[model samples]
Target: MSKGRGKMKKDTNIRIGTRGSALALWQANYISKSLSKLGVKSEIIIIKTLGDKLTRGVLSQNRNRGKSFFVKEIEDALLNYEIDIAVHSLKDVPPDMPDGLILAAVAKREDPSDAYISRKGNFLDHEKRKSIIGTSSPRRIAQLKHFYPEFSFMTLRGNVETRIRKMHELKLDGIVLAYAGVKRLGRKEEITKKIPISVILPAAGQGAIAVECRKKDRKVISILKELNDRRTSIAVEVERRVLTKLEGGCQVPVGVLARWRQDTLLVSAVIASLDGKEYLKEKSVMNQNNWKKKCDDLAELLLNRGGRAILKSIRK
Candidate 1:
């Protein structure tokens, strides 16, 4: 690594920009620690995002407030050269990055599955009681409604600990969260069930951490390259491509997961109505060498099978 002031000033530590949430801080610190092991020092700079500005009550009232709600500010900071690199929860990152910025690295993925947390051990046991579950994700609410129509759902948004606390304060039966966040935050024991992927296909890039930097900065790009996990990078690339082709975002009830099966890639996706009355799912397996083309093909298949109508209805 070049320490001299060519692209950057001499002896300057890499400035890592991130959101102010606990999980976001954990992600930023994780990257900083990884960089330290590589003989590169870093500093974490917390930035408040649009999503962070809204109260949980206000956010719950407006499910689709804005696109890239959690990342736009931090990305802007990176673009303005206020920070050298930005670490993001990959699921919160949009399918298309802002111009002149690139996704430089993807850390190894964690569980990438949704988890159910409740006072009791199983969500199914509450089916007879017509229990309510708390979660703000349209994808999760739609899929859960598909399986358990009798149960009601309420919108709840916050960090993992805050959500769990709200479950008690709000007197809700339980809540749904990404298992990766629970495990990463050391709250795995609170998980009632690690819902199977077959039950709930995760949002694209659910469990991964992304490192992004200015495309023109070779020094920062070179430093980030060492953190890339090829398998994780390729899988998320396929997942994000499917999302881009489908034109899905936080408001759209879309779920996609891709993983390597031996030497081939296995991908699955679903698009559903908010009421769970209409659902479309597609799966494909293709050689790793041609996953990108296969991703487009898979997306087209979904669009043809009523996905277009489903998303159109949601938009209205």
Candidate 2:
């Protein structure tokens, strides 16, 4: 086919499934626009998951038996042929997935680092240091225990907006969040400080968007070949493989964030006990091209060294 004809042919119709939330919609639209640039026509279908239905709980508080907490409902639609593909915040997706579902693409990531939002100028106000900081993740809780043990934290469960509003209502000093989410929601002004990823190793796949499709959907995969971001995939995959190997669940505290600088990958890992008194933090720099293997090896080493001890301590 001629280049023009190929462009026209690439204008395949696609249905993108996503959660009916502001941040999800933003990510979906961003993908849709990027697809349009390559002549693909797309629409978004909103699907609700169990996590979305819950109003007052954290995922870690719930039990897991291999079912995905955030992506299962949407993946069901993909398998049923109700939707061609599903887009998600990678952090929300569990490390493991259901049968017949495959993570097809990961878009270029934004800042994977967390942020602190304080209404009173500086994100973490020493004056309000004794006040509460809102969050629902045990990983965050563990880190807080290790670093900012004095600050009080409560389960701030709900959508992004709801959590932010709750922080205002409680008149808490500040709330912690993923920097990427706030930027996607167009709430840059709400940011009080950009937390360093160096210290707060982010959740796996935190800043990227995930596209999942039925493993058999070759057409959808063919079309979405245009949407894959290789660098983002490499970085997220490296971290995710570690999670998979170590049996990381939302309930435990394990965080890893790896950054690519030219030819080198700087990886940082944090393993913390449930009580956060004892912690194992480590960092290593390796050739970026071999990051995937480096990360997997690091996860293995961590488990053998002190990660196993930390996990056992936390589960008890």
Candidate 3:
């Protein structure tokens, strides 16, 4: 570990737990660099998971799937004290953390928007059923089908780069990926179209990087806290609280976007059917003084109205 230059200067080896995928490595390395700026050196520990090994089809399409698809392995490492901190894509994390784990810090959120990588055309061309598209998210699949039902949908498997390659080699069409991942991987140029949240709502915490560490370790938590972004954390908390209230733990097709402006938080959530036919959308503003309460109440409203039915439908 390199020594820091000032008050943070300390000889420390921070183990950063992350998936072994290129996109995951890129995110972990970025966080490592940020920690170094605060005078703490970080070593990235690659994690392997069932989700990464299975590249046969859409993860959401698997009935036996768990929200831990991208999380379980690293969570185990944290539970066993094999790593000091774990960096994750907030969208893929289950609403509930392991009993002893903590979501201690979150990086500043990214675009929180979806990006489309079309081969040589646009979604409209596909809307005409002239092309086929591929993806792995139920949220995207549902919305895409709703908007462009005539186009064919297929399962997308593998890591970010591999999926990109798969789309090109199979010559199917384009893929829908989070803009944050594509940008972080430095492949922004590959994006043929960047979808805005106004049209395509993103998965909860879509573009944010979350850090999970053992709840009892204050030293590691303190070290990681130096990199937390206040505004991003607040907004994501709003979105996450909504997920918690709705009991959306990965199998559910839920989406949300939260923004903070003038000391107020505006959050929107959408619950949809697996086949992209039915949906219930809601948005609300939270007073700066009682953000959590507002977020919880709004989430409750959605769940009671039609969210429960949607959940039951997806389960079958």
Q: For every model in order, what is the number of clashing pairs?
A: 0, 0, 0
Error of 2 at 265 (Å): 1.8
The residue-level lDDT of candidate 3 at 147 comes to 67
Cα RMSD to native, each candidate?
A: 3.1, 4.9, 4.4
Candidate 1 off by > 4 Å? 1-7, 56-67, 125-129
| Lowest summed lDDT window (length 10), candidate 2 | 1-10
TM-score, one value per model: 0.94, 0.90, 0.91
Q: Relative to the unseen true structure, what is the Cα RMSD of model 1?
A: 3.1
TM-score of 3: 0.91
Best by TM-score: 1
Q: Cα deviation of 97 in candidate 3 (Å)?
A: 0.7
Model 2 / residue 125 / CA error / Å: 6.5
If the candidates were sorted by their lDDT against the true structure, best first, what order would they fall in? 1, 3, 2
lDDT, each prediction: 0.87, 0.77, 0.80
Ranking by TM-score: 1, 3, 2
lDDT tens digits by residue: candidate 3, 257-316: 898878878888888887777877899988667888888888888888888898877877
